[model samples]
Target: MNGCAAFCSPASTQPALPLTLAHPLAHHSCTMFFKILLLSAAAFSATTTAATTYKASFTQYGSTDTWGSGNCNVASTACGFYTSPGYSAAVSQNEFGVGPGAGAGPACGTCWKLTAQTDSSGNNLSNAGNSIVVQVTNLCPASGNPLCAQKGLTGTNQYGANLNFDLCIDSGASNALFGNSGVGLAVGSAVQVDCNQWSGEVVH
Candidate 1:
């Protein structure tokens, strides 16, 4: 069993016994055991591969693309409103898809990043200044897709429609009092509120 003879002999698979071969028989048993070990390893590898999930979410900062129904104490085309006169840019009536590209962002869609702030009333949540968490699922793939393996989600607005997430906001923050994650999107932290993918399942 220790030397090469046990492995190369033509009678390696059988017992080349004078009466009952010792070394060759032991080698044959070892070969069978090795095959079993290999098969078990293959099975474990296949199981691990089958159990893996390959979906991802991205976070980016954005605002409503267009204004809906609002009269913020600002110019004709602006978004949320700041309680203080300072940081007027922080406030606008526009939706998540319509902000005029804040903080090194795309005017339309370079990266639909998550804004870690909250908004409400078709707008970001006020004062609490938390970002929204929208979870878009599935994101059906298609040829010529502008977004594939991209890093974030984008807001959409063609008409006065609510261009929301593909996946519903399954759950949300509870920063109702301006601390410990607000009820909606956070202002400066990441939230999962955009959808490259979506689920058909809907519930109010």
Candidate 2:
């Protein structure tokens, strides 16, 4: 027989070849994996959009001793596991939408960016263009106290609206951010603030 004839075989005598199909379990797992990925992305988007911006005012808190154990009242411990410097603040219990000594206030340990400080007359102060960052370390602006109102805060109650921040004078934050004027944060000084739930923590 010729070489080509010898190498050829009848269709019926051809060797059998194995076939493989995708496993049902594997297919299911792959679909589930992709579903989880999409769900996580959606959750992250929601968190990013949750940051809120609102009008607020500022005042000076007394000595650092008022920090109550040095930990935020909400956390009940020094810095409440936070190790960053200047991580101190006093948020209005009412305005922040939480009860006093609740230790569950969302504003606790939150970071705030304060700027555009102006007097009751709406005239910007010397540090009008400057901004300062501080952390929430205490609860303040007690209801019906007029803490901000007495300090020259005009208009509605800052505590009622959760729009007040009583920064610690010992932190030197007043002079650093509001200028070294003989008076640190003159009473009734108005300021605009931006607060975020996660901006206060520092790794270093």
Candidate 3:
């Protein structure tokens, strides 16, 4: 049956009606179809535009001190290393509360954009303009350690550590985000964080 005839089954021996744009019912159906298509496309665009943004703190780490332990021994599991000499690899605390972790486990190399920094007093730091993107490489502070609790993380399996990143000082470029060889920002300094993009293998 043609478009018009498809909507109505006439009993008489009638030839299939030739569908035309001028047919009111046919035009209404086509209009509704296009409207539904446009609405679906709009909803998809909204979802893609909605990215997660939050605030977290950071700590700095060095190459020799932070590597060869936990999951870092496996290069594939290690936080991605920057090739530049001064550039250092970075690790994420399992307690950041964004990804999956049970004391220690792969976080699927999730990447984040460190957009701005603030001091413990909530003052915006000079380096707020320096945004750096880093991937999660290693689980930090061990599970159930008292130090993790001291950092305002109050859950078992290292779930509560307030620390968000272990910036690799050896990864030279990343240090600039924190300031002067990573010494500019002291440990426990608060920073604004945003979930800019996911990279590598993300779990869920």
Candidate 4:
């Protein structure tokens, strides 16, 4: 007979309404308080956890000219791509571990082969894989002038151990790009056309 009486009445008298089971909005104060408590707990948990950061840095030398095609003239020529049509750069990748020691512990490892694509980026395409390294161990003591190379692997012929480092360029990949940019093609991201130029192409 009554509207509000039939809805919020005692459970014993009613056959039970289907709408009450799926109700999202709460008219009562208790439901609202429960939601607030849940939210506060979630916020506290997020604030206490540490965040992981990672970056992949790389340096590549692109080979353009077959031989010495460009003249040494610094004026009109300006040692440009016509002379050196490739580029090189340093890339870095970092991961956050479970600790506050600041980059100390068992040590992580990473290895990379230089990948190249024709006028594009993402997933090294075009088959010109020239890997390179930042070689920064010697420069470590020199202040903010080191590289993102394999840790514990520097000086002598230890480039093989560079697999532990987050960034690296293998001998095979570098050889391909060292040939001809117009032939093998240019990798998009780290290799800029003008900035990190390279010398002669890899001879066949």
Best by TM-score: 3
Task: Write model 4 residue lDDT over 1-204, tens digit each, in one string.
Answer: 244334443455656444455234423433556578789989987766433222223333222334433322112211111212222122221111212323322222111223334332434444444444222110111123133333332311122222122111222233444344433224322311211233333211
**How would you encode candidate 1's per-residue C-alpha lDDT over 82-180 as one tens digit per residue?**
112111112111223332333211221111223333433333445533333332211212123222222223322221122222211112212212344
- Which ranges in model 3 have alpha carbons more than 4 Å from their true place? 1-22, 64-106, 142-163, 180-204
Q: Which digits, one per residue and each the tens of the lDDT, describe model 2 over residues 98-195?
A: 55545545555566666545654456676565667776665664556564332322334633323566665555555555575333433232232344
On the 0 to 100 scale, the lDDT of residue 154 in model 2 is 30
Which portions of model 2 show Cα errors greater than 4 Å? 1-47, 64-84, 147-155, 158-162, 181-204
Candidate 3 residues 1-204, lDDT tens each? 654355443445855445552457655776677688789999998987675453445555554544443322234434332323222234344343332233334442445566445654456666555566665555554444332333333322122324455565554434556674333433332232333432232322
Candidates in order, TM-scores: namely 0.22, 0.52, 0.56, 0.22
User: lDDT of all predictions, in order shown?
Assistant: 0.29, 0.50, 0.46, 0.30
Instruction: Name the lDDT of candidate 1.
Output: 0.29
How displaced is residue 52 in candidate 2, in Å? 2.6
The TM-score obtained by model 3 is: 0.56
Q: Residue 30 of model 1: what lDDT? A: 62
